[model samples]
Every structure is written in C-alpha cells, then in structure tokens.
Target: MVIFMLVKDVMKKPITVKDNDDLTEVIKLFREKRISGAPVLNDDGELVGIISESDIIKTLTTHDEDLNLILPSPLDLIELPLKTAIKIEEFKEDLKKALKTKVKDVMTKDVVVAKPDMTINDAAKLMVEHKIKRLPVVDEDGKLIGIITRGDIIEALV
Candidate 1:
C-alpha cells in the first residue's frame, strides 16, 4: 500500500493570499473555509510565504493587549498530563502573539516545499527533517500548485 502511494495521489489545490492582504481577510478565510494556513503570493503568483492560524493568532496577541483577553494563554493555564502538555504549550504560544505581525515575521522563510512529482516517502522525510506538518507543492518556477499535509501522508500509507 505504501509503495503504491505518492503525494500526487492526495494533494489538495492550494488556496493563497497576497502580501498586501489584511490580516482580517486571512482570518476570515481560515474561519470560513476551515483551513489552517495558505500560501502567500505576490502579484506574479510566486510563493512568498506560508500563513496559518498560528500566524494570525500571533498578529492578534503579540501586538494587541485587548485581544490577549479574548483567548486564554496556555502558559497561564494549569498543568496537564504529559501527553497533552506538548499540544497545549503550542496552542498557548499561538494565542499570545499579535496581529500586526507580518507573514515574513511568522513564516518559515527557509520553507521545505515539495515538487508534485516527488514521492510520498520523499515528502515524509522532508517533513520529519523540518518538523513540519505540511508541504507546499511547487512548480519549476517555485509557484505553489498544491499542498500535502501529514493527514494526506497517513491516508496514502493506509
């Protein structure tokens, strides 16, 4: 089952945003579409950065005091089981950031993008090395064509 699977078998068409797009618009898209992140593009549709809920949360919390009260920071919450603690800490960190933050500020600039033709194993290896959950599939010109998530990998493996 694994040998027969590849990234092309499960990748999703990527939704993207421009650098000039306001953070409000990004947040709206994420909420309405139930997406966590998107590829940031320029006028030419070149892949600029990747933005996610984590990015948006940073914009709201890090730069705004009032927004801070809107969500409880995990850092301020009581301790939890070890297994759940890891996920909780990550969530708390995202909640403590501000909205004025730019994609450049929060995005992983040294991104581990993938080619559509790459095998699933190749993508999985990159994911492990970079500690990322998704890969922005790019064309020869480095424009985003699709995206593959760890969920996609699990699906492929099964």
Candidate 2:
C-alpha cells in the first residue's frame, strides 16, 4: 500500500533566529544545535529570510576591493614573510567585523516555503527545483510553523 506523507507529519518545530541577531551568536546556536541553517524571523515572528553555512562562508571570502587593486611594491614583494603577516592581520580584522554582521545582512531574503498539508513528494520536488536543502513550513496566514529538510523526508520514507 502506498502512503501519502504530509509535510506536517515529518517537519520539525523550527529552531529560528532573529533577523537582527549577530552572526557570532547565530554561529554558536548552529554549533550547539548541530543545524546547518535556520529560518530568520522578524520581531513579529514572521519568516523573513533564511541563513546557512553557505552564507557565512560567502562573508569570509568577501574581498576588499581596495586591497585587491593595490599592487605590492618590489621591496614589499621581497619581504614575503612581512607581507604574509600583514595579510593575516588584516584577515583577522575582517573576520572580527564579519562576526558582528546581522543575520538580515547575509540571509536569503526571498525565502521559499512549504505548507503543512503538502505531500512529501511535492516538497522534495520543490527542494530539488530551488536547489535548497530545507523549506520553512508555514500556516495559511504565512506564519512559520515548522521546518522540513531532505533528511526528514528520507527518514520518513525508511
């Protein structure tokens, strides 16, 4: 017999983050919960965006335009170790600034969501089409209720 599984049956009560929350605290939460991403909620508790490890990684690799445009002098090039040390120090400073960034600054604002009554198969198709791993499950009034992930669907099938 074929069973039709709805998103509500497998979706987990979402662990959400506030849009104005700092990245440093969000990172701590992600680590503690062992979650790769979470839906961003506003003060009114509406899903406003989504954040993931991918977004954090993007911040790390964001290059400084001025730094990239400058060409090191011949003397500076000869002092390779000194150049490397300076670069490391600058990178450290950048990381510090990045950590203080707010969730809204880096989150994907145009979020794709799923309804609780939606079928698991349909949700999976949405995941594949959007190239996303999770979908925030919302209510009729577009309020976040839970989260559904690829893992959840896989586990439900087993």
Candidate 3:
C-alpha cells in the first residue's frame, strides 16, 4: 500500500523530561501521562535522549537478573505466600531508591528521530530498525516538536 501520509500528520506534542530530572519525577510523569517513554531534553530544550520503561526496569534490576526470585519446593509451600508478599514490598522499596538517580543517567543517548516531512512509511522503517516504540519528531535545527508511535501510525492508517 502506498502511504502518502507524513509524520506531521499524526505526530502529537511530546511529553518530555529534562536531563537533570529525578527519576522519581520522571516516573510520576510517565504514570500520569500513561506513556511508556518520552523524549529527554536539555536545559536549552534540545532533544538529547530518550527514556523508557526499559531504562527504568534496567535501573531497578541492576543485580536481580536471575529469574530465580523464588524456587518451588514441597517444603516451601507454607512460606510461599509470605515470601511473595515480602518480595513485593522489597521491590517497591527498590523502586523508590532507584528514583534517586537522574534521568540522564539511564536515558538512551543514541536516539533515532524523525522529521515532520518524513513519510509515515519511512518513519515506521526507522522505528523497526531501531526497535523503538516511539519516535521524536524534530525540526531542521533538531528541536523536538512532536512525537509519533506505533499506535499513532496504526490509528492514523485506519
């Protein structure tokens, strides 16, 4: 199918975070916006990076990479529920602690961006190649103006 749609046709104003923003604030912004990721901007409002739930998840789990959070055993049946509850509480605490860091520390600096005039097909290609869910739409001088995502493209196409 030939798509004449341009990125600007479907791009939405970006929900952004500052480089120095604390993860706590960023996390809250994400939750409030119901967004999985956002463009990161510098003090001069230049798009510098991108932060996503993957970044937060990686930060939260610096060490606990093993899936062996709990082991199943016949003798452990009675303790499973209590252990699970405790693990959940511990994870919450870890999340709070992880928020002490700045957004720049964990944000992906090597971001792939889209131009307003770019075709939706081209933008989709970039996203697929970069394995990113969202693409920041930047102007000629690289100023972030809007953002587009897989969902946005799909919605627009339909």
Give TM per candidate.
0.69, 0.90, 0.80
Q: What is the C-alpha RMSD of each candidate to the true structure, in Å?
A: 10.1, 2.9, 3.9
Relative to the true structure, candidate 1 has a C-alpha RMSD (angstroms) of 10.1
lDDT of 2 by residue, 47-133 (tens): 999999999889778564534425877776677666677888998999999999999999999999999999999999999999999
**CA shift of 44, model 3, Å:** 0.9
Q: Quantify all predictions' global Cα lDDT against the true fold.
A: 0.74, 0.91, 0.90
lDDT of 3 at 114: 98
lDDT of 3 by residue, 30-140 (tens): 999999999999999999999999998788874544324366677677776787788778878887888898999999999999999999999999999989999999999
Ten-residue stretch with the least lDDT total in model 1: 61-70
lDDT of predicted model 1: 0.74
Clashing pairs in 3: none
By summed lDDT, the worst window of 10 consecutive residues in model 3 runs over: 62-71
Per-residue error (Å), model 2, residue 108 = 0.4
How far residue 24's Cα lies from its native spot in candidate 1, in Å, is: 1.1
Q: In model 1, how large is the Cα lDDT of residue 20?
A: 67
Please estimate how well model 3 matches the true structure, expressed as its whole-model Cα lDDT: 0.90
